[model samples]
Target: MDDEAVIPISALQHYLYCPRQCALIHIEQLWAESQHTAEGRLLHDKADKPKMERRKGVRTVTAMPLAQPQLGITGVADVVEFHTGEDGVEHPYPVEYKRGRPKAYQADEVQLCAQALCLEHMLSCQIPEGALYYGETRRRTVVPFDTALRALTCETISATRAMTVSGRTPSATYSAKLCYNCSLFDLCQPRLLHRGESVQHWLHAQLKGE
Candidate 1:
């Protein structure tokens, strides 16, 4: 597949977060940055730089471009460390940087898994795991690329690709937990749209009574 036609690996995370948000950004070409997003970008500044360094038998690369043509997905990994194993082979271990603490959802994990998949295809080796570095916690959370996670990553890829191809934005459903935290909340207006839908339903019910 052409690079232009490939879906972004980050879309998997966004889709898992909210399908509407995913469509709004990827399909509708809309974006609004909140404090959270700004902070995240700032945190990524260091990792976004393209650099390579070797320290203590490990070679670390920052801002590595990753793509899996078969899966039609592409993205940049924040950091990928190559560790020399006992077999005298270098194993790629991707580490993703996030602004906040670990979420209750698997969005971050799925994103990392997608990166691992891309690296596995590009390097022709099995990636056993990766890591997520949370800025808030200043810690790394290890993520195992188990069967279930791989399955979920593939499923998310298919769903995100389908949504992107259809070019349809899902209707907004307001949830204080999700919507308010989203960077595009003002642009999405999920609460207002949900209210409109409620009013429309009420009007339809009145018309049915009449």
Candidate 2:
């Protein structure tokens, strides 16, 4: 109500995938899932359990709380590891748990960056990099927090907050690419919608033809 936007960190991933999809889920609170999403749900459920462990002067925690008050976004990370650097200062490293292998999208990186930003804002620390752990491959990929990623993190945060403040969901744009394994495929009817046709009217017309 204060005209300040409070967006969730996940919106950054949605926005990267599709603006309309992002708005639908975030602003309209609409969601329809498929097998892929279900699997992801289970994977996150397994990873989100809070655990406190120690290794070599570092403490690791799961389902760690994070926030960037200036950005007005709050969320939790899969794992937040703390280590003492050579200077004897405690540093935080965020490791994101993924259900699948590497994706060809900035969406994952954006999410990780958001978490890092939150840590930076909250702890007043300089987190130059983080790592991603992929469940499928059982590997860790390190991501550098360079100028490019930082800029994207800042930009996505701005866009997501702007979207939430308006409180209007984005309209679905017809894209055949979005149909693969999409539970909303039938509801969305990307095939017909992409052709600039309405499935309801087309079906009605077909019935008359019969």
Candidate 3:
């Protein structure tokens, strides 16, 4: 694949959350903002502003553009803190801001780890960990970029890239808990579509048996 074909790091998170959602957003360019999404956007907006600040021995840069050609993923980091070690070595720690509380899934962690991977590639340094700041709890949770997470991140990248290039939106699978809060709820109409498909399949089966 050409280096120019860069996939958004956000797609990895979206794909993990829901492949249909990812395809709808990236492939079809469909989007809607719900209260949750708006809150998340506001949180990201606050972090996305380009700025630099120093705190004690740590220097922080906000909205830093990060990309890894090998992974074909690109996105701006919310914050990259450069902490000076006792040995005078500087370590980069990426911190991502989220609107909601932590979830059972690895979507948020995968996103954070992808940022760390980008930092590793761009700076030619290894990052062992990063953090996710959740808006609901107003607390930062540290995440380790371990072997499992790294492997998952890579897999997500490849899967997301394939979905993006395929230009086909995956069919929606409805979940009341998830679809209710999704920004694209109305647009996706997961319940309606899935129900309609189910009915169609049932009718087809009846006709085939006749």
TM-score of each: 0.90, 0.84, 0.90
* TM-score, prediction 2: 0.84
Q: Rank the candidates by TM-score, best first.
A: 1, 3, 2
- Alpha-carbon shift of residue 14 in model 1 (angstroms): 0.6
lDDT per residue as tens, model 3, 33-81: 8888888999989788999999899999999999998888899999999
Model 2 residue runs over 4 Å out of place are 1-4, 191-210
Instruction: Compose the digit string of candidate 1's lDDT tens values, residues 1-210.
Output: 865457999899999999988988898787888899999999999999999999888999999999899999999999999999889789999999998899999999999999999999999999999999999999999999999999999999999998988866788888999988898886777866653232334346669999
Which one wins by lDDT: 1 or 3? 1
- List runs of model 3 lying over 4 Å from the truth: 1-4, 194-210
lDDT tens digits by residue: candidate 2, 1-210:
243577788889888887766766776556788887887878788558988898898988899888787777788999988997899888999999887899887889989999999999988888999999887898999999999998998898888777777765555576666656455566544545434343444556669999
**Best lDDT among the predictions, by candidate number:** 1
Task: Flag regions of model 1 displaced more than 4 Å.
Answer: 2-5, 194-210
Count of backbone collisions in candidate 1: 0
